[model samples]
Target: MSLDSVAENILNHLWMISWQICILAIVVWGLCKVFSRSSASFRYWLWCIILLRLCLPGDFFQADREGYYIPNSLPTVWETPVTIEDALPENYTGSSSPIVNEPYISLHLSFPGVIVLLWGLCALFLGSIVILRAVYAYAQIKIYPRIEDPAILNLLEECQKSLGIKKHIEVLLSPKESDGPFLTGILFPKIILPQHVIHSWKEEELAPIVLHELAHLKRRDLVVNWLQILLQIVYFFHPVVWYINRKIYTERELICDDLAVFYLGGKRKRYTKTMLRVLQESNDVFSAFGAVGLAEKHHFLKTRIIRILDSKYLGYKKMKKLTLFILTLFAVCSIGVFGQQQTTATKAEGEVVVTYSIFTVQDGKEKSLNPEIFFLSGVDVKKQQKFAPGEYTLLISQAGYHHILKKISIPDGVKKFHIQEQIQPLRREIKKTSKDGVDIDVVIDGDFPAGERIDPEIVALNGKDVRDNVFQPGTYRLKISQPGYATIEEAVTIPKDAKTFVISRTLSTNVRKVITQISYDVQDNKRPQITMEKIGTKEKILINSDTKIKPDSYLLHIYQQHYFPIVSKVHVWPDDRPYVMQFQLVSKPVRIRLDVRYDDKKNLPQQLVTLSDLEGKAVQVVHDNHRIKPGKYMLNIQHPDYTFGREKYIQIHPGDQFLILEKMAKKASSPSGKEYTKLFFK
Candidate 1:
């Protein structure tokens, strides 16, 4: 990629990257709130993700792109997709199936250079503000006298000893009625104390004041502050980032307060009083610049005081180790969240979220329907949330009607979309309901969706199946005694005006089903299931088994994980036929040896080759070694001299013995390692 191309890529994705930073900042804020009462260490650690978001260029943990379809997209400059096209050689045309970029959306457009020029100006403007503040704060510090009292020196030694601070911090007296106290310096740190206050105070009150500054150093808030100060300039336009920066400082003070209290025991009353005193007389100390201070504005100071007295913060005292453990976990997550290339499009530009709330309209009003109340997992809009701006599917179920699945779109430009859905009239019979208007008949029927009836022997109502039929005008608790399926207790209410009460019970064999969707790398086979032998090809079962089978004593086994095989306990229905569950095979991981020929006499070029499978796991390509699963693969082969690869299309079949890839040896005047690559999309 040239310099112009690099600049163009960044400019093209400038809005998206900024949008992602804002979103991540909001996430950091929400996570901090959840762990608010827990510990400040974890809360401060959460901001590290935001830091990583700004520092790292790409996404870390990739969302699932298996079924997520990206239309007419191109990969970014940072992503080198080892697509099937890249694996094949030039002048080779075996499979004409289209191959695209991995999970990245790119558009080749003539972007005006003025956007970046204006960006530089805005960044410079913010950067100048931060610099001016630092200069102004440092200038204000110069007006104060350096303190050297023996008593104050002895108190400072005590704070350093207790806080495990080895670096010598210069303590200076602030001007009377000036900045109360603050530790400031981009390169070095100094704690400026109030002149009139410290001299009149004893060790007890003075210890918490100075220890608060030491806590800033111990927690490394200075480094975090400096980083935020710089990044604010980079993302000055995004207000979410400014909010996050404010949150960092607010939480930073609370953390220091807690640390001071933890280290200086039996001083909560004194510590709280000292913090209050500092806030009342607090000047433009740390508040005006990149420094840690005792207190800030009244609004933030009040929140800190309330949080300081919060006894719940002490509950996490014994769990400091757990906080450290969570910090470690967060650090580990940062590796995946920051280091990996993002292979999927998230909430991008012109995308909006659409949320749905379904209601049943009866005689005159709208009655809100809650899926949880009926133990149904219909469109869980409450928890599942509104999907991104795209076509979405929703399943709504009511007692009378068949489950309705409606496809809707979250149109662009709109932020929050409330889709009003009204329930339709019943088309299918409510088989799970009553039989007659007189007596209540308890019948075990098939599952709700499949409608396959299975007779469960042990059926009881309130532990008494003997008297479930024809009950009085009241509600009865009916239960089905089954093992695999959940214990279902459905209530049947017999109205005063009704004659017979019929209650139908739905029994499901499997609670969860894993559907393995298969995609042919070469072409669409239109087959639902594939055997291991006939993995990735046109060969399929090609038959729809329409014959109905009875849900008997045999267990319906299904697998969830790729390698995990599920087995169930033996049943007692006396049905003795083995049933096989099949999955559509997308790609097969087969062992193959690649024969790369340059010349009959010359040995193959010594280079490293690797391939990424459908699941995006990378495996090195060694001759006659390593088996890979079936899927679309990206291949990379490195050579010392001339370019030998292109955006070629090659399909590896299950029954194929081996593949012979040919490369012509061309002399190069200059070794442009990747100049021979194919066009992104054709």
Candidate 2:
């Protein structure tokens, strides 16, 4: 596949996964709210489920099935194998012929392509932001000095042991006093402390801070933080993702706080006091750098303080049963959301009830499949029967209709099978005879009016002479001939029940007469030579006043020296009346007459008038008349005696005669000068 197609597939998958995540997030949110009294650790795990679902690939739970079986064995009833060609009508010509020229292919972008392009660009932009932010965060943390104080190292080791964390973690001290203690890093985790907190705070007051930061390490929240960041970058356009990310962050902090309070010997007041002190002294710049900091926004801080101070909130035990139930529920729901069965045709072993209906193609009349004539593998079949799972060939033959032979397969699991077939009628030679003479009507180009009759010469039927337009009732190749019309030959069937068989045939004319009339916009004695060319042929025929040509559409090319050539399409039908083609040609040169109606005629000679074409090329004017090519031009008239020069835009068409009249003041006046411009045809 092309890159565009792959990207489009990814975009479609992302859209599907996005909505699925939205539903999962809503469900998890509702569960967390309903279990409000539960431990934050439980709610945190629920959000982790959302994160895990985001990482799942599309089609993770789809089923796979085998291919369907198609019956290929022929029936033994018909010893001679029948093919589709034998079932087709004798007059069937198949489909129409392909076009001579290749079709034009369009390069226009489709709507889905545009959408995919936009999605790719946005994803690339968000990805760039994420990478840059990560890089900047790494650089910011690298500058912090590593803490070497034995007292702080001992305190950290004590906290890690208390939290049952076995991994080795680094410690750093921030130089700025406003920076709070935050937990950063994944593989080599680090906890950065504010400079003032290390120097001013005592061991008792600082224990809660160290414990809170270590609690993040125990919960493996740094890894979850990375997942949240990845999802935020991928689903940047999705509002639900951002909402869920916020909830995860809030729940994550609360869970860590719970761990810190528990490790601090259940002294909620002491832990709460240290959290408030850290929040007061530090800003939230570390969180933007992907660090789990003690500082939070005012609203989130308020909720945290309220939850920590509430005596009953911390007393609630972890509901392990409820957590398990919710986990199982979400697991089932996830399976329902993402699980899809792979479609395949499978074969099975079972008896299939088969029913069939046959009909004539010409008329929608249903036909019966006789048991004696119609058979499946030489076994006589009924209207409906139970068949073992296997391939079988059915042969259906009617008197007038063509025989139908089909191969069908009965799969293992199919309970019922329906077969509907439309049979084409065969072209059988008519053997019936009629008594009275057969009446024949011949129409020349649909020209025969009502009650109007013209006798056309009857040629021959089946190579036998047609006597007085009468014939024995049988199928014959009827041939018709007329003086001005083309010959017509077709098969005709005569019925025995009818006293008189009527035949009607319409014939097209072979040749037509065309009359050409040429008129010019400008009166001239020059006559343009008109040539005619058929639509798809290269031969050009010269057309005179009266021309006789085949009945087809033609392109007429009329051209003369110093005149624009005219090309037009003319359709000549096969009719009695001559086709008349009228064309009007235009001359190449345009005429312009400039009449200067000035108060003083002597100033006209001093008027420097020039006409410039649209390209600013000047056209020479002689005797106040200019003959130039048809186009738009600028007419500028500048006189030393007038107050202002007159400039106007004019358009000249082929064979156009324009007269421009301009009245100018005799003397150069101030603001009250009068000027009149009038344009008309000569």
Candidate 2 lDDT score relative to the true structure = 0.64
Candidate 1 runs further than 4 Å off: 1-7, 58-112, 282-288, 315-682
Displacement of the residue 258 alpha carbon in candidate 2, Å: 0.4
Tens digit of lDDT per residue, candidate 2, span 622-647? 33455666667787765545533456
TM-score of each: 0.41, 0.43
Model 1 agreement with the true structure over 167-286: per-residue lDDT tens digits: 766777776565667787645668887766775766777888788888888777788889888888887777877877877777678778888887788467778888777766655334
* Candidate 2 segments whose C-alpha is farther than 4 A from its true place: 1-8, 60-109, 283-285, 315-322, 341-682
Model 2 TM-score (2 dp): 0.43
Q: Which candidate comes out best when scored by lDDT?
A: 2
